[model samples]
Target: MVQNLNPATVQGREYLAIPGPSVVPDRVLRAMHRASPNIYEGALVEMTHELIPDLKRVARTEHDVAIYIGNGHAGWEAAMANVLAAGDEVLVPSSGRFGIGWADMAEGQGIRPRVLDFGSHAPWDMARIAQTLADDKTHQIKAVLAVHVDTSSSYRNDIPALRALLDDLKHPALLMADCIASMGCDRFEMDAWGVDVAITASQKGLMVPPGLAFVFFNDKAAAARAAQPRVSRYWDWAPRVDPDFYAAFFCGTAPTHHLYGLREALDMIHDEGMTRVWDRHAQLARTIWAACERWGSSGAFQMNVPDPHQRSHAVTSLRLQAPDGARLRAWVEAHLGLTLGIGLGMSTADDPKGEGFFRFGHMGHVNGQMIMGLLGGVQTGLTALNISHGSGAIEAAARVLAGR
Candidate 1:
């Protein structure tokens, strides 16, 4: 028999504050409740036809977009498939677990990866990266991969600056970005930022389940793709963007439910307006950080991000008092029915120095009340555990949200 896995729901209100599989909008969830569609039918075909342009608008690129029935990792594979051949050289800047995973994927594909790591929190040294590109006289780097936001650390790197660096040095490397965290939550301009290829998943800012992955590419990347001698058919962007509805949207039978979910998601994004959505997220995130700062100054807590602007508007990492992080998180989950995010790439958790860190996700359907509820739960947990913390964190967050 299956075990009772989760704690009982919080008296009809359980909070899923984990970074991904973000709170789904009721409309989107309802959209997925219907039966599957005939892949070749009129509505499905017409819906498929309308999807690409909308998806492109979200990515801020008029270039090609491909959808796959997979997660963000598949998006990475597809982007790489279009651009890399066996033994091709690529430069990878890893700031966290996700970045390292991308480099490893490239390696598995027989692409030679030259890595420059910037830890889990900060962005790469721009001058150093520019010099590296300038120093590569042979132009051995076929592509340069960077993560726009490292979800694990809630770090948002400057993609525009990376593009500027490439332009300054006249680097021929095709620039790629993993915008999984920053896509809808954080402001990302693919064409404007000179991102030749970009990838993302559905679970984060897309407000959906973990079934869809999107890859966006530009003319330069397409041209480079044409030059690839060993592009995988399944991952090839050109084959997928066949100008026909069926081939363009799905190579095999469509992920009908996910398509429905995506359609609703897209509608919600466009209706709310992407710009306004991003601004709302930014406002909410600032409130969270403000609470963290107020708590940190009490000599009991601190935010993991060194700079406020660099911290992702989608997620925030908080370092709590000594050796109580894991315990406190467990207590919160058990008692309040709230799920907190783990520090994916951090070293010291529940340590003697009390460097335990946790992350809070404020992406997609999250809002002022959701954030307040989350912070309120954290405050409750801290008090119940008798953990030293400054009071009024929730109030600070409320004021931040209220524009006080």
Candidate 2:
């Protein structure tokens, strides 16, 4: 590895700009670097009790939350297992990879998914969703699985508007939001938005490693859970949230270090204030968009989502002419120690490998200078690789960061 490495990258700490498993803060790292505590009793148990409310605060929900010892996929399954049994149906309006992945998971579990693919670049068409609900005379759809922010496409769905649509049509379908990417980065009010259930993982916006996942549910979703005849033991949320079954918090021994890391991460988020954390993410996203817009002006650099309102503050997906995206990514990582996210589910007829697409993750534990450095690295790669792009991208990004 050392023989093939660039001198600049060999010394400096590499920055990972992937959508999930974002840069973990030193505080969180320190918190996790500890001896395993007794799961039966003591500070670990007490901290577990405290995490629920803090986690709820991050999701902006005043409902019950179940902590699962798994990733975001586990959270999705956990949420589905509680309210949806085998042969049940769900309405999935997919925008990108993660959305489709959730629906696929449902299908694998014997549940049917009615997917209305809105393409990878666009947000869900409200008219189509409204029409779909109106067309459902018997209300066979048990729940509407909405991905709040698809990390693949970097598009943020309008959860509140979707709730309003369900309300206007008097749809009985429960609203379940997949907030795996948007949890602490975007502004999500579960109660105010009328979302019955929401799922997220410790990775992404929570600024923790990939281990713990959370499923939050309201009274209506709880009723739906009650309606289910039988749910898988490991995926059941009732026991996880029940105070009487403390030992069953994770269906087993518990992820000790992950919980500690999550606790520290939650503390950092609270200390920064949820509103401010969201604001910071939005501003950083704008900074990235600013630079990308400048670069796109003179080249094949195009942002996936055209509308700024629909774009996710957590991540930004971009496309360049075939092979340029891959070239630039390789250049940056090898020379500047900056790793960009690979384009996910953005393939087309011309570019079958999705080599023209790449993504920038600006969520969780990111600051203005860090974003500038990321942009600077990309700019350098663009120049080094002789990729045609508009100039002054770094300046444009800096201006946005400076509030100009």
Candidate 3:
């Protein structure tokens, strides 16, 4: 029989360091811990109205945002449904798991995804994308689905560059970016980057628990939706854009607690200011990367994306020998109360079972001490597991955090 585990039994505060569903702030939690409120009018309704503008500020867009009662995948389906019709060909420039997963979602939606697979380690090859778009003389590809940051591989792609490519090629395809992992962590300018449609979730850098998904679309993408044959009423953004009450924001009853949590989370983001939030995430990521570099020097580990310029501020994917990654992860969680992200797309010939990979998420509600503690825990795990790693990994990370 399984032993009953109580929260008090845990030694210390547990760290959730996965790429998403990141550590929620105490304020957000306090905001969420409330009885159901009046969903029709007054505070709840007015608070809901405030969310749109704040969300747009984070997305860096003046476009319309539609909130849905779902996860990131729901955002995917909603964005696809709004702008794509059955059998419409979409060009998916895949760099990692989420990229390919988006393509799979498109396939399920009765749309043909012409995926330009760029493997799991690197960003998209612009030349290939340019050639593909250039070769499509008939312009059958209606849209380009790009993942701004692939949390699986922790690789950041160039959305603005993709948009520039589209413009240079004079392609009429709409540029849709999946910013699920990067919205608040990394710098994403939807309107300035020329993105037609952008998708993100309340988790990740937004610092809210999973439940709400947001889809932001410009006038061009809205026009495309209007011209499309049909979009499921449930997924349609037209009505949700200007809902009369809270229930209308979602299809039915409002996600009362999540909305409350989201209001507080967005307030936190705005309070810090978006630029500082981006800088904080970036600095935290760099500190982690610096430590990982030291750890990798012993040949026992490696970073999936070696280039710092291409890596994501939200998460870092690391490759190790088979079972070392898994063992280290198990040890850290079991003994040190730290949770690391799974190596999402790193299954390889030598590393079957994907046991040789893990990720470190440094996004949302994370601070320097938390990151230092996380690294210290990992270093302890490495030593306890007898995992070969260079010395002074913690010191290296500290130096980075100290701006040395």
Candidate 4:
């Protein structure tokens, strides 16, 4: 007979500190908790229409947006299918795991991905990118796919700098950005930054569950889509761009509950203001870094990205000795209620398995107290796990929060 082991009861509210699928706000949860609405025509339809404008506002763009009934991967496929066909070549300036993942997705669509691997801990090398584009006299590179803030490495690429490099090289290749991890938490101005296509999902900075993905496109990207040989009906944005009703918006049965949650999430974002939200994420990230810096003095832990300016405000990746990173994560969740992000395979030249790193997310709905709790939980885990760490980590974090 199979034995069923009952899990221990964990007291108090659990903290989800993973990079994406951030803790949903109570208001968004309540909005999603309600019953499914009518799909044909009603308040749901009107509310669904409102999402595009608000989404554009969050992206700080006037370009068009199409909502897909899928996760971030769907947005990736949609962006590629519309602009690229079989045998089309795209330049992927890889800084982290997700950048390579995007290249793999492009390959699935029969598009050739020319990747310039920049390892894991650093930002993109703009000079190399510029040279690559400049060498492509025929402009065989249809687009340059850049990840704005790679959650795996917690490295934030400068999109505007890439745009300037392209302009200087007189490259006509479209600039496509994957803002899945940075959309609401970091500063991204799609149109102003000269991004032709931007992709994001509901999970991360959007402060919602993981069902919906968005693809924002400018006139240039739309023209590229028009020039493509053929795009699958499901991935095509033409019909979904101006839908007649909720079903048409999604190309099938609408994600009614997600829409409700998204509406509430967007409301909260606008109410708090995007600038303020970005500032909060920045401060919390700094606090976490301060704590990690103080802890690193004992030679047990260090931040993945050494330079603070190059790191993402949404997530911070920390490096520790083997087993300690993994053990600390397990210990925190079992003893306390805090859950930290796994060390994704963002390997540097020295550390290949990436078992030495873990990520701390400070995006969406997360506040100062919540961050302090997260840091406190980590400190407890370090002590409980018998991991060697310098003292004053908590004080260091508090000082940062106190702006001393």
Candidate 5:
């Protein structure tokens, strides 16, 4: 671990700018810092019931949501278990590591994954996906597992357009979306976009801690569940969404503190309104882009996705000269108390270890000043490390934030 050169400066509250498990708001922390409540029929039970509708609101859906006491991967497993069976085939359109992870999870559960890899830096090729679906004349593909936003590459796939393609081809495959990264940050309309099932976790844009996960599914997905041969009792969504007992919400014991924290987070999201929440993320992303574009003009710095339209508003993937990505991240964290995300699965023939890649997570509970501070820290790191970069990078970022 790199130690802070100035110990006195590292005494303050540290900022976490990684992709998931985003910065938890003070209100959410306060909500969870209490004695565990009664699990049977008191506030916790009623509150859990209330959380379902609010969670659906965030996804812009009026479907059933089953809560689980696990991380995002657990949500993926739960969704897969309910609607899909062993030997079933699903279409996975991969843009980055998260998408590939989901496909791997499906294969582990005895399902076959037909992955249409689009590398780690580009968005999905709509025509290619359409061709794959069109070729499956017998409809062996049960579901199209779509990742709404891949934080590893900071690319946002076009969900609505994919839905349109499926419609045009008259395919019978269910459209399941993995919105673990884009639920509250990006504009996701599960029902409006004709998504059959959607899964997400409490971490990321929900502004809560890791642990709690949710899987929202419509009637079509529920019918698929009914047709399944058998599902694990733990992964079953039937009892979870419509439970006879309160304990069925999360199988047995409840996630006491996480529930309290999630309730508070949902209140904050609704209070701000989804429109402003998305707008804030969009503006912050543009601010980061402005600075990165300036830096890339003169150095080895470059944004992973060339088209801004294909990028995610929650996180930005970048590349510097080999070894510079690692050096700059160390410099900022040690000296300025700011941490950035490591490049995940961005390896190439030249940079096999992905030493030249990094990411900036401008997700939940972030604002203008926080983003400005983040960019300023990076600017300082580049200068201190003697990396060749353009001037006025910070100025470019500030101009975006200032709307100049």
Candidate 6:
């Protein structure tokens, strides 16, 4: 049994480290607290208008942006709807579970997926992508969907390099990105990367509650909109972005409260400036790697990805040897109500060796104290569970954050 728990707990407190539906900032939570306001009037409409350009700025695209009441999956379908017809083939670069699942979703929609499955933890090999695009002599591949950072495995990819590869091969396929895991936390230059379409959600790096998804698309993708045979209005991107009028962004009336929450979250991002937020995430990512390394050197624990540079700063997915891995996580949760992440869609080859790898999420409204808490919990939990790990992970992380 756990001991010495507090009722109110301390302020500037313990946080969710399992990623997505991240701890909504108190300001955002406050904004969402009231009953529904008139969808088309007062501050609601004003905030809606303000949100458009600001979202564009964060996406780094002058192109259109669509807001949906659904989650990231909705954004994915919206992006696909704008660019693909029922039978069109899409090239999907599968680096981890999410990418493959996304492709499967497209296939479910009657869009065929041509997969290029690379081993997990590696980026899309440009040569493999180029070769696949090159071999499409009939130019059947309609779009290439790339997941920027596969949250499940903590791997980041080079979209710009893939774009260059497509340009070099003269591949006619459009480039689409699933940035749900990395959008607000990682460096994403949509326009610069020449991405035709990209999708993200509020739950991860946006520091907002779930229930909102954004799809950004360039003219090339917008052009394809008129050509798609049938588009489910709710999941269609073009209409939502253009929205003849403001009400259309949310379809009929609105997910009124969600927009209120989103407005404050976006405001926070702006106040910090997106560039600085990206830098903060990058720095924190390095700190996480240092901590993981200190533990990994003991051989009792290991990171899923071998290369520090390749792993995500937003989420760290690591494998811990058991009978301690599961116990350590439960120990942390029971002791402090601090929940670590469970491995999701980790395949047969990976799961049999361990109970399930744990994940650390550092995205959205997170800072050093929270990260330190995460490491501290691990340090204590390892001791509680009698697992071996190097001490001073918290100090190493503090040193990194301090340097930043």
lDDT of 2 by residue, 1-404 (tens): 11343585646688999898899999999999999888898899999999989999988889999999889999999999999988888999999999899999999999999999988978899999999999999999999999999999998999999999999989999999999999999999999999999999988999999988899999999999998899898988888899575589988888999999999999999999999999999999999999999999897899999999999999999999999889888888888789999998898788999999999999999998899989988988888777889988888988988988
Spell out the clash pairs found in candidate 3. Answer: none
lDDT of 3 by residue, 100-157 (tens): 9999999999999999999997789999999999999999999999999999998999
Ranking by TM-score: 5, 2, 3, 4, 1, 6
Best by lDDT: 5
RMSD of each: 3.6, 2.1, 3.0, 3.3, 1.7, 2.3
Q: How close is candidate 6 to the true structure, as a TM-score?
A: 0.94
True-structure RMSD for candidate 4: 3.3
Question: How many clashing pairs does model 4 include?
Answer: 0
Whole-model lDDT, candidate 6? Answer: 0.82
What lDDT is obtained when candidate 2 is compared to the true structure?
0.91
Candidate 3 has a TM-score of 0.97
lDDT of 1 by residue, 148-198 (tens): 888887788889998998888888899999999888899998998999999
What's the lDDT of the predicted structure labeled candidate 3? 0.91
Off by over 4 Å in 2: 1-6
Alpha carbon lDDT of each predicted model: 0.84, 0.91, 0.91, 0.89, 0.92, 0.82
Candidate 6 lDDT, 1-404, residue by residue in tens: 43544644433455578968788889999999998787767888788878889888888899889888888988888788778988899999888888998999899889999988885656677788787888898989989999999988888988888898888888878899999999889999899889999899989988878888899988888778877777787777766766787678777878888888888888899999999999989887888888878887776687787877787879888877654566767767767778888766554464564464778889988887777788887887776666778766777777887894
Runs with alpha carbons beyond 4 Å of true place in candidate 6:
1-14, 347-350
Tens digits of per-residue lDDT for model 5, 145-234 = 999999889999999999999999999899999999998999899999999999999999999999988999999999999999999999
- Checking candidate 4 for backbone clashes, the offending pairs are none
Candidate 4 lDDT, 38-102, residue by residue in tens: 88888988888888899999999998999998999999999998999999999999888999999
TM per candidate comes to: 0.95, 0.98, 0.97, 0.96, 0.98, 0.94
